[model samples]
Target chain A: MNSYYEASARERLRLLLDPGTFHEFLPPSERVASPHLLQLDTPAAFDDGIIVGKGLLDGRAVLAAAQEGGFMGGAVGEVHGAKLVGLLERARDERPAAVLLLVESGGVRLHEANAGLIGVSEIMRAVLALRSAGVPVIVLDGGQFGCFGGMGIVARLCDAIVMSEEGRLGLSGPEVIETTCGVEEFDSRDRALVWRTVGGKHRYLLGEADALVADDAAAFRQAAIDLLDTKPDLSLEALTAEHERLGGRLERFGACRDALDIWSALGIAAPEKLPLLEADAFRAAVAGKRA
Target chain B: MEKLIYEFDGGAPVKATQGPAIVGVVGSGNLEVLVEPENLGGRCVVEILTAARGFGDIWKAVLEDFFARHKLADLRISINDVGATPAVVSLRLDQAVESFLGGAS
Candidate 1:
């Protein structure tokens, strides 16, 4: 398991940014601690496992946050949540051209109890607020900590999403799904099947990902930059048309047992090939031909 | 192996008769309780399920501890846990119950 941050930060944005352009705010020096972990007999990191700040890429005013997978699996707690809220609220006030959240979370921090839930809810509010302010909120799920639980909903709500072959996005974790639906519905032990069902490729084909890119940050940044140009706004006519289309899609999947069934319905030709291809090749291969 | 169900009235007929009004997340190391209004003959019923077994007396002691401190009723609260301390759990349960019972709308 390579450091996702290292692999991503290096390949993705390390070269994309001009020298000295990315400025980190509320750095470890600020010592923002997780108010919840103190009681859990655990040590809290300086940024509560998230790296947040303001940075410039091609002179684009970007505010961002990334999970520090090294610390407690990069879970969100009260302070972590508040800091993100504060950052997004500040971004809204400033009306940045774009906001990218490098989400690498296990969703709400259960250790913190209700505080983490409130934190997630507050972040959701801030994301919606950003959209209402007409700022593009972009989410990149490029690796292992794949967004889950409430963050899955958050990603779905984002104006745009960029994913990698390694990226995963879903409301319930495989374990939860298996628990709720039994092995027949899903087998959490089957890693490849899990990836095939919820991996970025599957999501991209589903029209959930605006663009898919390589695991490296450079590729993801380029993809992210490309997607920033598109916005999601619904017209009444379009909404009705969409409902009609989705009605057809839903009907296509009546009583469908697995994502593979949906995949096959979409005519992937070879759904099994999804998880193996590199992010770029896969996206190129499946461009259009899907919703 | 023992059980205790605590009750209180936050000084009035508060919360819904039934239907959930949830707030909070249950992430690793934390838990949140959702309190909703339900008319089971008009009294708040608290049901708790926790992974930390063998603490029934302590659980009762804490809820008893909380109910004795506040006035709350007309709501049913269910708590889901992933290993949180008593203090955080209590605070959230109180807040959820308070929110459900209706306050500053």
Candidate 2:
């Protein structure tokens, strides 16, 4: 297709897997749409804005799901969230080569607040269960909407995350931050500042995202293929190492006001120029400095 | 919060359909319709749970119009609505029927 980052959920699924290997479950035609949005006079999509299915990634059996960012900001509602839980649960049972989640959500749909929240928690539980079962869950956050709220935490809990420079990952959105903490604290209109705070590059530097790849379908597919063969042990030793790593981050830059300060603190010679560099160049610059 | 239940008669049984099918989302100004095959003896049953109250008459009129247009029968249509307009409700009903008939799949 065009660019993976700009493609729709179905297109992303097609591009990520080998051609003609994608088989959708509860596809839009099935009309398993949400029953809640209609009561409130809101338009709804046929597939509840999520496409879940089984596909082949480089000839390996894989289960994949992608969110539709254009539909309700890719918010996770009851059916959308349930589809993810079902997919992950199936992965745990089937032990697919990997479970790929093309996450582009803004967390729970506020309309169905309670149900959405419960669904997200269920997804987190399913992700943990799949991980414990030795099934890898790979998350790809490359959509313009990014991944935020409970979805951000879900992405972090995954085995691996592949993000693009154009993508963002965080708990709260920029607008929410600005609304909660005055403009002086966080100017939501400042695009650069917002991206610097939670963009892919920043998350990669913080060791939150595993791989930073080009915003292309081929690039993302290649990155996933490269990582599918290696399964990182989530043993106590690994958990301890990860705990220390995150603890060190908090100790070092938890008090830092600006993202540039964190970059400079990490020995990135020029923090301002970091965002302008290409993915490869950016990786090289922060290769040794990344925690 | 409004709870409305409307049962309509004089409709043919839904054909070429099996099992349950759902469509739409319960977002602001939106709603969802779930169509499940039931032995209602040629009657179409509709249950509406909405956040907007005092619209039972409007819901009745809209649902009556939908039932008149489709040959839906022996089905249970459960709706969870926020404040969807008549047009959206009609559309979701049609979508639910289409899906019930194995059109989308």
Candidate 3:
């Protein structure tokens, strides 16, 4: 697949596993239909929008799932979302060592009415349930489509998130934000601001990102390995502390304009220079410097 | 053309697979696909129920090629397309494997 995310997924597996070790289930063969799209006279994909599976890492069991950006920008439909929630619940029951997700989504599919939204929430519930059950979920964000809407919340729920410069995490897209919050608040046309606001670079700097790596699939694998090895099991106090810190962070953005303002607030003298830096350099520059 | 079902193998039978599971945007340039495990026999049923019906042959050819390339089994696939590319279709197939079989390389 020439698309960056497809390459990323394939590369992620190659770097994470030995050759010929990975297996694909329910592939395109399972003619899973979208209950919503049929009403709109749309074509339905076999797996809907999300893919869930089980794989192994170092002989340890790991539950896996990836978003199909190729299919409707990997949007969530009823069947697709149900499948995700079901598999996640299964993972919780089975208690895999970990669950790894490669997210490339645009959030809920409105065509399916509330079903899609419910599915997203179900997935979130499953994630939180897994967390509550002492299992870990690691979210990987590095697709061109990015994760948006309900998915943004899902990204936040994970135990840890590893992102790429290509990854984006936000509740709303720039255009939607512009439509709702007006262009003054968010210029939908500005790519730089979008990146600065919710892009992986900014998230990494803000401590929302546990790790930031290149788009290289192998790099993602190495990073995932490094992350799985040292998973942070935060206590409720730590979680609260992080939440308090995050609340303050979001408030600071309330009165801010350019993303540079955010960087400046984070104590970077040349905030403008950070965007041009690689993921590692930017990560190093902002290490322990977030508000 | 068979109804087969299976759960996740819980591992990657092969190395890394690539691509998107859904295509086309909710809008014009957007689309979504779900990539997960159907874990059936090697024969995957690619069911395409699209508003674009004449594309049945196109759908068949695509699935045939995808099944041949990936060798997915016990898998059932459903696609909701607003018009994606061959590029997108292939990616979604890869993603289905990735999502279905968590964390395969």
Candidate 4:
């Protein structure tokens, strides 16, 4: 009954991991808070708003991390960013069974601009390194904060992604789009439009997300456990297929404005009803149509 | 570029067991403290880098109180402060000390 979108970083980790098996690294008690935030007179959390640790998922060893969105929009500062890098590096060394990232971030912290940017790049490199080592990095983006900016790119680079219908995944945020392209192009206040453009359902249909699950923590955790059984092929052939898929998206939806066009093109009857359908019903409808 | 450096002497010698310990963050109204074991001739050295200038007396008072209460010795404490209150500074120092003494991993 617990919603993943509303859960705290610790709560989400507990729900994802097996019962009472999570071991934290550099926990809040270690007080590895950001040194950059102090110079800017901003309140900082002891763990730098990101919890990196290890746990068991269905009795399998897994490395996991979660972002605290309530703390400064879950922006990545120096220590926060370093923790992510360190986790991935550890994953490379330890070679865990899997790596799960419960991402809810707006990307870099503006307070530590340069350092945050560099940190994100370092994390991206680490992720690639882990992926190259055949370690599956899965992302579950179901939090209310969603994932945007550089984190979006990072999510895309991951092996697989499981997101809720309410979860959004995009490189640029709605506000940024509205400000840069004008309200006529993108009205940030239009919730429906925003969701249509970046929500989990849309990303799934676009082939950006691997799976779309319900908003509950149990649903997400189940989906993650299921994914662990199947290792995705990261070969060049798969990469080429993904490239074609992305290219096809641009060619198909290049001039499309209304999301209805997309739904209709995908052969969904009565595209208007798709948004209001429940998660299970929607999945069924999409499956039937695809079949 | 307003930086303040002060060193205090005549404090009870610390056990100096750990390498270094850090606590807190540098954010708005926050700061980070780094404590390292050093042989400073029984003196506790303090270095502060702060954007909020013209508070030397307040900084001195806060650090003095912390040093007096803890009686720490042979330690080099560096602070990167924004505008954190005396209470926060004190708490960070305590946290650093506890962490340095193998309190938490």
Q: List TM-scores for all candidates, in order.
A: 0.68, 0.75, 0.74, 0.74
TM-score of chain B of each: 0.72, 0.92, 0.57, 0.91
Candidate 3 yields a Cα-based lDDT of: 0.69
Candidate 2 DockQ vs. native: 0.07
Fnat, 2 decimals, each candidate: 0.00, 0.03, 0.37, 0.10
Candidate 4 per-residue lDDT over residues A1-291, each given as its tens digit: 889998878789988889878888997546687777766665566688898999999999999999977677778888988999999999999988889999998888899978888999999999998988888999999987789878888898898999999999988889988999999988989999888889988888777777888889999999999888656577899889878877887898778788778878889888788788878888888874431
TM-score of 2: 0.75
Give per-residue lDDT, candidate 3, residue A84. Answer: 77
Is candidate 1 or 3 superior in lDDT? 3
Q: Which portions of model 1 show Cα errors greater than 4 Å?
A: A1-16, A232-246, B1-105
Error of 2 at A214 (Å): 1.2
Model 1 over residues A130-218: C-alpha lDDT tens digits? 77677888888875668887788888778888887678888888888899999987898998888777888778887888777776666
lDDT of 1 by residue, B1-105 (tens): 122355555434653343444433444556546565565555567765454667766676778777766555666666545556778777877776665555310
Q: How accurate is candidate 4 locally (lDDT)?
A: 0.83
TM-score of chain A of each: 0.89, 0.98, 0.90, 0.97
List interface RMSDs for the candidates, in order: 12.4, 6.7, 7.0, 6.2
lDDT of 1: 0.68
The candidate scoring highest on lDDT is: 2
Docking class of 3: incorrect
Error of 2 at B81 (Å): 17
Q: After superposing candidate 2, which stretches have Cα over 4 Å from the reference?
A: B1-105
Q: Which candidate leads in TM-score?
A: 2
Candidate rank order under DockQ = 3, 4, 2, 1
